[model samples]
Target: MAALTLALDAMGGDNGPSIVIEALARALEQFPQHHFIVVGDDAELAELLAAKKLSNHPRVTVKHASQTVEMTDKPGYSLRAKPDSSMRVALDLVANDEAAACVSAGNTGALMTKAYFALKTLPGVLRPALMSAIPQASGKSAFVLDLGANPVCDSDTLFQFGVMGAVAAREVLGIERPRIALLNMGEEDIKGNDVVKSTAQLFQQSQLLNYIGFIEGDDLFADKADVIVCDGFVGNIALKSCEGLADLLLSNIRSNINAHWLTRWFVKLFYHRLQRSWDWLKPDHYNGASLIGLRGVVIKSHGDANTDAFFSAIQQAVEETQQDLPARIRDRVESVLLEQD
Candidate 1:
């Protein structure tokens, strides 16, 4: 196989260079054949690399950019006004085939906007959706799409998401005939709004997808579905709610144990078990979300991602690159769209 080069948007995310630098170092150690082109201001990146003693790595290089698009900046304005921004430069690398993939922990909206405009989409793809995998109960994970990519979507768009998500599950998760479900308010066929009802009907009729009917929010971690499709608005709400509930459960568990000496002793007895369970639920374990249906691979990490999260994002980029996710999704989407035509 050819060498895989990844473009890292160094100026992105809340932690900036620190998290990116750490992730680069860690990834280089794990996958020595992989190379990275860090995009940011030359002088600042150089100083940081020197401080970390990473300037000598053969697999790492820096590409300088003078400006950065802030998280609060409007996606359209940033893409149009700041042509030389790190995010734009990163996309250019993938567009020109200089990089196998691009990863950013920046403004999700801006990154997706830039990617869609610069790289465009597969021939028949109406829109690209962001798909992220979340850990479930059976030592497995579920893929959720439109996780803040297109907040408002029509039935056709949701149907596209289902196809794109199923392709991703097969490629990334190595699942044959991956089970798919639409995110809905009820399990019955006539439960959701018109968009959901229409999309459900489409899935039910389509032979390309393994549509398993409606899945409510509670079924997210039940392992009933391998890929869950929803509009970006509902997907974002589901993701945030899961994270919030995880935090609350962990806190409640800790507080209950600390309330009394006997409880503390019991907690200490089961500390390792508790830690193991909590580790499985941490966001770091599943840190990367791919923007599906684009011409190239673009993985987005959380803005508040730590070093571990950044590292996991890099691993995800490598895995998706190896799986050739973009090509797989393109093929699947083309087939479905052709059938519709």
Candidate 2:
């Protein structure tokens, strides 16, 4: 297999180029079959690379970008104003076929705007979706989509998301005939609004999907369904809620364990075991979210991700590119359309 090259928006994330550089160093060691192109201010990125001893590394390359889109910059402004922005340049790398994929922790809207314009959507795809995996009890990840991409989606859009999610689950997660469900207020048929109800009808009617009816908020990680589909507004809130709950639980556990000397000693005795159990729940372990239904692979890393978390995003890019995710999606979508015809 040929070595995959990923373009990184080195100046996009909260910590700027330093964190991206750190991730690059770790990625180079972990994934020997991959190379990277870092885009940012030449002098700053060079200094960070030198400090980390990655400046002379063979697998790393740098592309000088003069401007940067700030975290607060609007998507439209960034698109029109900053032509030389690192995020735009990185996406350009994928568009030009110079890199297999691209990764960024920049403003979500800005990244999406630049990416959609640069790569376009896959054929038969109405729009692109933001899909991420949430760890389930069965040791498999349940795929969810439209996470903040299209806040107000109609029935057709939701159905399209289901198709894309199913293909991704099969190709990337290796699930055979993945069970799909619509996220609703209740498990009953008469639970959600007209949009969800109509989408459910479409899923049930389509032979391409394994439609399993409605799933509630609690079933998200229950492993009851392999894929969950919903509008972006609901999906984004659910994602953020899970992240908040995980943080709260970790903080509460730490505070309780050290509240008393007796409990503190007990916790220390089983610290390793507890830590191993909690590792699965950490957000960093599932840091990458793929913008599916695109012409090329684009991974969105959490803005505040650390070195390890960002590397996980890069791993996602490598795997999806190797799997040729977009081609699989296009094929599945065309099959569905032909079935309808």
Give the clash count for model 1. Answer: 0
Q: Tell me the tens digit of each residue's lDDT in model 2 across 1-341.
A: 67999999998988778888988888898889888999999999889999998886898889999999999999999999998999999999999999989999888899999999999998889889999888898888988998988899999889989999998899889999999999999999888899999998888889878999999999998999988999989999988888788778777888888898887989867666777666566543456889999999999998887787788898889889988999999999898888767
In candidate 1, residue 189 scores what lDDT?
82
Per-model TM-score on C-alpha atoms = 0.94, 0.95
lDDT score for candidate 2 against the true structure? 0.89
Off by over 4 Å in 1: 265-276, 282-286
The sequence of per-residue lDDT tens digits that candidate 1 reaches over residues 259-297 is 989989898677668877775675533478899889889
- List the candidate 2 regions with Cα displacement exceeding 4 Å: 269-279, 282-285
lDDT on C-alpha atoms for all candidate structures: 0.88, 0.89
Measured by lDDT, the strongest candidate is 2
